[model samples]
Target: MCRWLAYSGSPILLEELLYRPSPSLIDQSLHAQMGAEATNGDGFGVGWYGLDTTMRDMPDTRGPDVPVLFRGVEPAWNDQNLRELARSTSSGLFFAHLRASTGSPVQQTNCHPFRHDRWLWMHNGLIRDFALLKRDLALAVDPALYPSIEGSTDSEVMFHLALTFGLTDDPVAAVERMVGFVEATGRRHGVEHPVQMTVATSDGERLWSFRYSSEHQSRTLYVSAAISTLRNLYPDNPAFVGLSDETRVVVSEPVGSFAGAWQPFPESSYGIVQPGDDVIGDFRPREP
Candidate 1:
């Protein structure tokens, strides 16, 4: 299994969460407190939207919503380049993941935060018996998007399957459909409890996070208390003072030990973070 975090709010340097926080993602790469394994050092990736530099000529228009990605096969904590990039880059929405391979080769393309036209996705779980189910799952991807597949990891395939099932149109339903398909295929192959996951995806403007397992015992995941609420609860903490009310974060675990800073996302649930109040709702698999 792996660990990941998705952030949305006022623009801030990536290090603010990736490295500055106690038990930060950098720290978790080598000393995770709640991952299936103590370390997730196989590889790592970060994807974030940058200011549309291409709009110099037509400043009023927005360009294509493609995210800039930085992926590496090195352990996150050991990668100086990632540290430098984190210090220099600032984004309002971004994804970071620390990978601990589950039978997948270690390579740049196999890193998390897989990206598409306007989406970035990462996962922290496994599709049981993936070797037996890879072909069927890969076939389910839209033929047009099939060519984009570049790695031999179940997480990457899951992202593409969600895309084929209309993720851009309705992320929750698409992911449910993807999971349902996995479960059906696994059962067809005599495998039980086919999925274990805590997935996060974003379209730059909004973020969706989900946690579910076929056996009802999924990995750990937490969503931050709303910035406004935290501000009220911890009036003296400077960290909550400057952040906007819309700031929200979802992590594989609490970023720090701060009391009241994090809340457990219910099992079989998904959450969406957008302009107004964030929404947390029950999640159930749907047959494709």
Candidate 2:
């Protein structure tokens, strides 16, 4: 339903990931190769970390320091401001999303990469029969955090649910619990399938990406082959020569047609990318 990319590594200009590739995220915004739709023009957003505002004469203002966000309710390819920002801003951990709203209104608030505190999240699929489950899920969120929700998208609800379930402390467990609750509630209402999602979240450092569905099939999700591997494959491609071993990416689709350069995440799986380790784990349906 949408297209997105999450990148982590040495600081680099946003355009390197959002615009430079043959079929970059911006290209996917207008001509997606694997998404359900060809265009994701509903809206777009980008989130990046900059040197802490309090830091002075920052050698590099980019990287994991302060989180900055740019969002607009306009086609990404047509946004002049996005183009300028992509060229000027840089970061080691960043997220870019192009939306094809699934029943949600086309507004800035409805864009993905919704943030709360130090975390940022984005989703590429929807919650089945959301209208039926919305109230139930809302009632379950911690009252103290409910007032922070600023939009009416299922994606936002999912984020808040994770926060309520201890996301800040144990993201994997919190998300599992949230999804378990969703599955249980949906089954009670006679919905055979109640979820379809490929979600990513970050707290300015490590990143967590998930792929799951109530049914067997889920949306497309991929993680880039390590930069070292890419360098070995394309020795002459100077673009990746300076990247570190920990540099990695998780994207909605392959940014280029480089065979074997992008690996499809296993169905019903989730991945965690830490400073030095990247791990993929199974996501089995929870028993109601």
Candidate 3:
């Protein structure tokens, strides 16, 4: 499996989460305590929503403020470019992933945080028996959207499947449908546990995360406690400085060990972080 994180609210240097934490995302890339593998060295990717400071004053010149992507086929901890990029960039919302390929090739295109339009997606688990079910799942994608799949990883396919099922209009429902279809397809191929995932996605505005497995033993996933709550809990923690009440993050595992800073996402559930109150609700797969 992989280790990934999604952050929203309060634009700050990406390194604050990617590297500055005690056991940060970069540290997890090599020493992940909750991942299937200790080392996620196949590849890495980071996607963030930010406008160039130089262009912020000229709104029209900024064009569309789509997320920017920086991916590499090298180990994240070993990549100087990744470190430089993380330090130089800041975003109100961003996603970072360390990939440990299940069976796919190690390549730049196979990295996580796949993109389409203003959306970004990344997954930390697999579609069991993917080789046996790939054909059927690929055929189910809408023809117009099928061509957008640029990688051979099941993670990419899952994203396109969600898009085909209407992610833009309703993200949680689309993912439920996507998982349902994958499970149905896998059953036909004789795979018992068809899906295992802890997925995070964002549309440059709101962020959504899902944790589920057909066998009901999904990988670990954590969401940061509300900034206000954490601040009250640890009034002098430097980490809370400059963070907004709306600041939130969802991770495959806790990025740091600060007391009460992270909470486990319930099994087979989904959560959304948006403008007002964030929501955590039960997730049920539906037939696409």
Candidate 4:
């Protein structure tokens, strides 16, 4: 498994989100409390929106206003270059991920938080029988989108499969089809439980997260309590007071044990976070 976090709301320094908190994402890279693996050292990546361009290199320069992706085929904690990038960048919406290859190559292209134009995605679980599922899944991606599938991980393939199933028009529906296809394909190959995922994606604005598995035992997924709720719970906590009501974070696990700071995803559910209200509801896979 892997560890990842998605942040939306008041502009925050990447350093603060990745390093300042107790058991921060960087810390999780070495001592994850909830992931299947204690250390996710295969690789790492980050995608952030609206950051100073002069401070870092970018994969897609859609400009300073657009999201930029930075991936490294090295442990997050061991990369001083990543530390410099994190400290110098700031974004209102950003995702950071630590990877533990579940049969994928340990190259930059295989890192998490994969990007496709304005959309970014990362996953914390696997397609149970990926070697059997990959070919069928790859064939299902839109032909026009097929050439753009640059990585070999099931996570990246899921993103493209979602895109093929109409992600731009309806993310939830597309993911439904994607998971459905994975399950259906796996069953044909004699795999008992084909899906196991805690996936997150963003389109430089709103955020979407899903936690589900064909067998109903998905990996850990959590969303932060509303910033307002945190303020009331910990009146003296500066972290709570400094956040905007719009600030929200969804992670593989809570960064800290702060009271009223995290909420677990309901079994087999999905959540959407935007500028207004956030939502969580039952999730069901559908045919593509």
Candidate 5:
């Protein structure tokens, strides 16, 4: 139970995505349009990557560009510091999440957009009967990575499971395996529909977004049509006029009423965004 947005493209100030849009992530925190709840004020977080200032000399490796993170137990819309930072910092890849804390406490650590090393993750759904499967899923994580666990949310545990299943190498397969394992474990413990999710993750370069549920129906998740296409469609809208082809956003819902500028991700599918101007890779379930 949360709402999130992931942006990867030409560098833009965080406010451009978190506050300026008509139905920005901050607006969703107070008045979500498609989320299960109207207010997702339990907690919030933002993670972003910028040029690795320390590696100015080395062009071979991506370098030690540490992500900047800001999280708090307060609602996103209510945080003055968030607004201040959003206006000041800029990044090519960033993630923002507002929580509707299911069973977890309304604390800073329980916020979405959990991070590990260079990876950042956020989820908008739950693992049904989590209490029953928590122990099993937690144990499934590599013991070495277990100590890093700091929160009590199912979303955080799911991140670790994906890592254990080799997310860094194969995010799609790792996530599928994670869902399979969670479903299997949940069924063994009597949960009818073991999972529901619309999740996003990034390693500061590429972004992966997935929409799935044990049942055929799942929560809302959408990716913006290419900015070039949107600009063409809404030629008179000044807000979209300056956006380049590389600008892309994936969110739980559209950020504004630019018709045809957003498309719903098909149920039971995932999308991968690579480093290019508006290039997208779409994936569906493999044949049984």
Candidate 6:
């Protein structure tokens, strides 16, 4: 349904991830190599967090820093402003997505990389029979938090549902609850295999990426090799020369063709990434 990428680590210009690579997110928007469809041109969006600028003396304890967002109704490949912003902006953590609408309107509001407070979320798969399940899922959302939802897409509702299930306290558990709830609701309504997703969500400091579906057959999701391993593999390759040890990228497809630079995530799995090491392990649905 879409293609997306999430990057976390030392600060770097958005162009370094969205444009510089051979099969960058921009290129994937137009010629996706692993997605079911070759083109995802309905719309796109990006969300990133700037460095902590609060004065030390002030000691701001507000939750995680909220991210800056830029979404558009145009294809990422041709959005001049997206390119300009990518070339000029930088962040330690960011999410970028290109959409191929299934049923939602092709408007800015329906773009990926939906945000709430300090969290950013994007999805690349559909919730089977979402139309039958949306009302139940939406009703489960915290009424106090429901008013903040501004769009009419399953992905956005999914994000808020996770929040209602306690995403801020524990993302993995929250998503499990979300998927369980969706699947249960689907069966209750006679819809089979209720969910399919390869989703990424971040709270500015840490990123959680999941690959899961009711059938145990989800979309493609991959993670980059350790920067140190890549540097050793291609000592002379400029692409690996400047990357930091903390650099980590999770994508719907590999950004390049290098053999050891990327690895496929096992089916029914999820990964968590932070400033240092990253972790990957199995994923499975739980009771709602």
> Which candidate achieves the best lDDT against the true structure?
3
N/CA/C clash count, model 1: 0
Q: Model 6 over residues 1-288: C-alpha lDDT tens digits?
A: 899999987788899889998878899988998897899999999998874344335544553488878999988999999999898888889999999988889998889899888989999988877888888889999999899788888899889989999899999989988888888999999988889899999988899999998888789998988988988888888776766788888999988668888888999888999866678877767865
List the candidates' TM-scores in order: 0.95, 0.94, 0.97, 0.95, 0.91, 0.94
Ranking by lDDT: 3, 1, 4, 2, 6, 5
Candidate 4 vs candidate 6: the lDDT winner is 4
Better of 1 and 2 by TM-score: 1
Question: Could you give the C-alpha RMSD of every candidate to the true structure, in order shown?
Answer: 2.2, 2.8, 1.5, 2.2, 3.3, 2.6
Task: Mark the 10 consecutive residues where model 1 has the least summed lDDT.
Answer: 52-61
Please, what are the lDDT tens digits per residue for candidate 4 over residues 172-277?
9999999998888999999999888999998887999999989898899988988878888888878777678999999999897686788899999999998777
TM-score of 6: 0.94
**Per-residue error at 28 for model 4, in Å?**
1.1
Whole-model Cα lDDT of every candidate shown, in order: 0.91, 0.88, 0.92, 0.88, 0.84, 0.88
On residues 159-231, what C-alpha lDDT tens digit does candidate 1 reach at each position? 9999999999999999999999999999999999999999999998999999999999989999898787888
Better of 4 and 5 by lDDT: 4
Model 3 lDDT per residue over 105-178, tens place: 99889998899988999999999989999999999999999989888999999999999999999999999999
Q: Model 2 scores what on Cα lDDT? A: 0.88
Native-to-model Cα distance after best TM-score fit, residue 177 in candidate 1, in Å: 0.7
What's the number of clashes in each of the models? 0, 0, 0, 0, 0, 0
Query: Which wins on TM-score, candidate 1 or candidate 6?
Result: 1
Position 148, candidate 5: lDDT:
86
Which pairs clash inside model 3? none
The CA lDDT at 286 in model 3 is 83
